[model samples]
Target: MQSYVNVRHSAQGHPSGVSVLCVSSELCNRLGACHITMCGTGMQRCTLNVTLEQAMILSRNHGLMPRCIMQTMDIMRKQGPRVELSAKNLKVMDQMTPAFPRLFKLCLPPSDGDL
Candidate 1:
């Protein structure tokens, strides 16, 4: 099992992030689903039954940038499975690491309230 957090930061460094849990091919076969948590102004969680390769391909073809795909894979390889990306956990992480590089390129513009 492997996972990575794809974080985006506003110009003022506010985090608007999405966390992805990348399941390896073997693990995907065994577990049959991967948990995904998306965080920004709010959070949503879902389960998807897809292997790492399938995920990469789908993301690439469906508008995810190339750099994001590469970085996500790299993080997954290095980090293994450590953090569970629930909303509370992500908020804790946001507090701990406020300066992570803007990993997500396709970010929506922050609303006036976010500023």
Candidate 2:
């Protein structure tokens, strides 16, 4: 039923719709573990294809961006995350404003400039 639904939705003009693949165990054995490179990690991973804005949003939402740019350099390098950033995203990252690190549970007072 879900397959039928997917087909129907796909047929209805959603070209970028998510795709699903199901294969028999026999086929899986035959295919084996073919070399497949993956981007992202765990829940912080990005989609197979993503835009620059999307990438920035994902990284920020995942708390990958650092509040302190200089300090986070080591952390970002050590993690070695492969984010396919666009030119725009790169520019924004370069001029990033000071803010709390992503995913930090501790409360931070709002920036002094803001009321």
Number of the top-ranking candidate, with lDDT as the measure: 1
Give the alpha carbon lDDT tens digit for every residue of 1-115 in model 2.
1132122245567743322311222234356643222333311223222222233333445664533332343344344343423322467455543453454323334676865
Give residue 88's error in model 1 in angstroms: 28
| Model 1 steric clash pairs | none
Candidate 1 structure quality by residue, lDDT tens digits, 4-23? 33555778998643333433
For each candidate in turn, the TM-score is 0.21, 0.19
- Among all windows of 10 consecutive residues in model 1, the one with the lowest summed lDDT is 42-51
Cα RMSD for candidates in order: 15.4, 20.4
Model 1: residues >4 Å from true position, as ranges? 1-62, 82-115
TM-score of 2: 0.19
lDDT of each: 0.44, 0.34
